[model samples]
Target chain A: MEKGKIIELYRKMLEIRLFEEKVFELYGQNIVPGTIHLYIGEEAIAAGVCSNLRKDDYIVSTHRGHGHCIAKGARLDMTMAEILGKKTGYCRGKGGSMHIADFSVGMLGATAVVGAGIPIATGAGLSIKLRGTDQVVACFFGDGAANQGTFHEGINLAAVWKLPVVFICENNLYAMGTCQSQVMLIKDIAERATAYGIPGVSVNGNDAIAVYETAEKAIKHARHGNGPSLIECKTYRHKGHSRFDPATYRPKEEVEEWLKKDPIQNLKRQLLEKGYLLNAGMAQIEREVNDIIEKAAQFAIDSPYPPPEEALENVYA
Target chain B: MSMHNGDGKMRVITYRDAIREALLEEMKRDNTVFLLGEDIGRCWEGAFKVTKGLAEEFGDERVRDTPISESAIIGTAVGAAITGMKPIAEIMFGDLTTLAMDQIANQAAKIHYMFGAQAKVPLVIRTPFGGGVNIAAHHSQSLEAWFMHIPGLLVAVPSTAYDAKGLLKTAIQGSNPIIFCEHKLLYPTEGPVPEEDYTIPLGIADIKNEGEDLTIVATMFMVHKALNAARMLKKEGLGIEVVDPRTLVPLDKKTIIDSVKKTGRLVIAAEDCKTAGVTAEIAAMVAEEAIDYLDAPIRRVAEPDTPIPFSPPLEKYVIPDERRIIKTIREII
Candidate 1:
């Protein structure tokens, strides 16, 4: 990546980290109504992966999808207002957190049902192919979703049809408290790609450079009609599955160790070490990000709730 | 051998042929329309051959064949529909709908509502259901009630070739997702349907046979049975009117209530199970809307609450036949 591109990637990771932290704060203050799955530690994967997609290219997200939505160009205020159940939200308070979407930017909504987004992305890729467009689709799911049937079915179909899709599995070590070792036999979920006759690779999801390089190559291959690929981002969720439990089931050493390798801090240090960002510039970026989040929070708090009667207004065409 | 079959300006055709013709006509008219499902191609010809010679005309992309992943098939269709295309997805048998309930009920039906009406899911899920084929419970089922319960979906249960052809065309062109129910046993049944380009706006009830004593409201294959029972009851000096509500969701309450007020008796007949079924829902509608006009309590003739059996005698015992319809109508009258 060029210096400017590398700096932009670092900025994106910082934005996502700050955004998620604000969500955690707002959620703690009881501003958010429904439950949320925070994309706390896995910021680099979303930023790196979405950075490679065009505005018209599609993406399907999972429950823990705030980072993905923001990285894919969704307005921060609308997403925050959505989590607060305000009518100004992207879904008009109907979808809340997990279902927030902006079709304008080709974010095909989120599916809370684990692997359900896989088939939807593959289908969107199929639609692109049918319409004879060069648009690609990036499907984001967790490691646990790799075990779901939709994962296998979706990958197999995309392989056969050579649909322009990239399946990005953010293997956060634990799937909502259950460690990967407890649920999967294969240590590398990327190896499952062989079954579908596609290329599979595991990358350091915390390293934005590694993920961006890998994703750029995969996306290029797909956009050129080479077929779909599996990219497993080996990362960790810094927080619990939702805003509930403290993730006490995980060992203390493991949690502490993953926290030390936090992607946001790592990217900041790298940018400084590489002379791409100065100490003053880093401070400025942090302050700017804080200002943006504060504005988004204020907007979310001031937004009004939808009228109770509008709930049934959009149930049909 | 007469083309018109003595009907006004329409040719006689089987229900299967009418459905096929509808697909052909719509696909020809709109380039965005396509068909995709398991066993729907040049070789399989759609398991029931409803798509015979379509793949040759439309090619593999238009009449696409899928693997045995009903979830993927439907998910793909929903994704495709919301994006731009009008996909007529087939689920072979209605019983297999259990395999795809999430994509159909949760995803396709709720996208328009859940997204604050940002998108229109113009998708049609066509499936052949009903127990008369003796294909047993897994392959045969009358589960229109399952889809009718979903808020965003439009449920269409066409009983004749005319309604089937006209309604399928309208469903393909409409803006909402539709569960197009076609009965397996009714596919070969023939009726008069016009060949001219026309469409039946949904929510209109088609009165198959008119009478004065009672309104025998029926659906799918049960409409034919009600008509047969109407014929048998006419010999006994009993006038039984048969009403087929072509589309169940946007039900024609005006026609049904009018018929009930005129006859003062109603019997809701369906192939679904008796309790909490389509029959029960219709009976509740008639009771709620036109109770004062009723001469007697609304009766429902429906399948017993059990899985359709494989043995001929056992299956015959559960499914409502002409004898059951006639007997139930006589009691209600």
Candidate 2:
């Protein structure tokens, strides 16, 4: 990868990390309402996959979608405002964290229903095919969604129709609290792709470079009209499913073991080893990211809530 | 076949053909329009042949056939609609819409509002409802009330060829998600339709026959049944007015209320179940909005609260017909 592109990826990962940490802090202060599924550990997959996509290209996200949104060019201020339920949000306070979308950037929005966005992303690919556009869709979902019926039905449709979609499974080992061992007999989630006659691959989700390379191949394949492919990024979430979750169900040693391979630190170390980023350079980037996230939170706090009557608007048309 | 009448040349076509014509015309008029569903393409055409010969005309890409995945079918349409393409997905049977309820009720219907008006779902879900052919509980159902209860979905239940063609054209052109419910029995029924392009905007009710004694509001096949019952009552010196609220979601409450105020009596006949069905909504609307205009107890002619049976006798017993509607009207009047 070029130095400029690698630096860009590192900056995006830091942005996500800092933004999520700020959201966690805001949640504790009661400034953020409802619950949030943060993208603490699984940053590489989003950065890697979305970096390969153009602004016109589409990406469908899951409930844990802030990372995807950030990587797909969503402004921190707008995203923060949306999470704050302010009128200045991307969805004008209508869609909060789980449903935030910026159509201008082709972040086709996120669906709270697990596995539901898979078919929808496939449909966007179908639209690309029908309109004869070179655009491709990157559909992100959790390991748990692979077990949902839509995973099968949606992927099958895309494979058969040869729609331009790359199915990226962020296999975080557990779905809510259920471990992958308790769910499916198969070891690798990518193996499921063979059922639909598509190329399937698994990569280290923590390694941003590896994920970027894997995604590059899959996205290229889709853009060339070779049909959909499944790329499972084996990663782990640093936090619990939601803010309220203690995650006591997870083994202490297992959690610590995965925490060592945190995606942000992994990429940072790689940058350091390559002499691409010095300690001072990294410190400056951290300060810059912190400043951006703080401004976003402050902007959200200062922003006014949408009028109650605004709820009645946009019910139709 | 065409007829020359007072309103220019009118082409008589089957309800099925009318729907097909609307689809064909829309596809020709807009390059963004395409279709996807189970067995809706060439060979199988459609279960009821509503999309027969469409694939050969538009090519396989536009008239795509899909697997028996109702959720994905509707989901794909929702995705395509929000992005650019206008997809018309057929659910084959209205009963099967339950399988895709999440996609319909949760995703497609709510995407526009939930996304803060960022996108619009200009899509159509066409399915056959009602129970005249005795296809049993799985295939035959009048599930329009389910969709009408949803906030964002537009429900169209057209009875005649003219309405089907016009309403369908309007549905295709509109920028909202629509559940276009077709009746199995009405597919073969022929009605006069104009050859030229026309569209019947949703939420508008049409008065099938004008009268003064009573107002009979119906939907889908029940509209034809109400018309027949009105004709019979007209001969008996009881003038019965028949009203068809073509779209249930954007209901023509003013038209129905005006008719009720004029006639001073209201009878609702629908093919769905009696409890909380389309009739219940219309009756409640009238009772709430125009109760003082009512001279007698409001009556509803709807199917009994049971799954449509395969046996002809049981099916006939449950489904509301012209006789049941006429009986209901007589009791109300």
Could you tell me every candidate's TM-score relative to the true structure?
0.98, 0.98
Instruction: Please list the residue runs of candidate 1 whose C-alpha ends up more than 4 Å from where it truly belongs after superposition.
Output: B1-8
**Per-residue lDDT of candidate 2, residues A1-317 (tens digit):** 87888899999999999999999999999988898999999999999889899999999999999999999999999999999899999998999989999998999999999999999998999999999989999999999999988999999999999999999999999999999999999989999998999999999999999999999999999999899999999999999999879899999999999999998899899899999999999999999999999999999999999999999999999
Candidate 2 local Cα displacement, residue B279, angstroms: 0.8
TM-score of chain B of each: 0.97, 0.97
For candidate 1 chain B, which ten residues in a row score worst on lDDT?
A: B1-10
Quality class of the docking in candidate 2, CAPRI style: high
Determine the TM-score of chain B of model 1.
0.97
Residue A300 Cα positional deviation in candidate 1, in Å, after optimal superposition: 1.3
At residue A284, what lDDT does model 2 achieve? 97
- Give lDDT tens digits, candidate 2, residues B1-333: 121224656878999999999999999999999999999999799999999999999999999899999989999999999999999999999999999999999999999999999999999999999898878999888999999899999999998998899899999999999999999999999999987877888888888889999999999898888888888888889998889888898999999999999999999999999899999999999999999999999999888899999999998899888988877777867
**B182-204, model 1: which lDDT tens digit per residue?**
99888888988876777788998
Give the 10-residue window scoring lowest on summed lDDT in candidate 2 chain A. Answer: A1-10
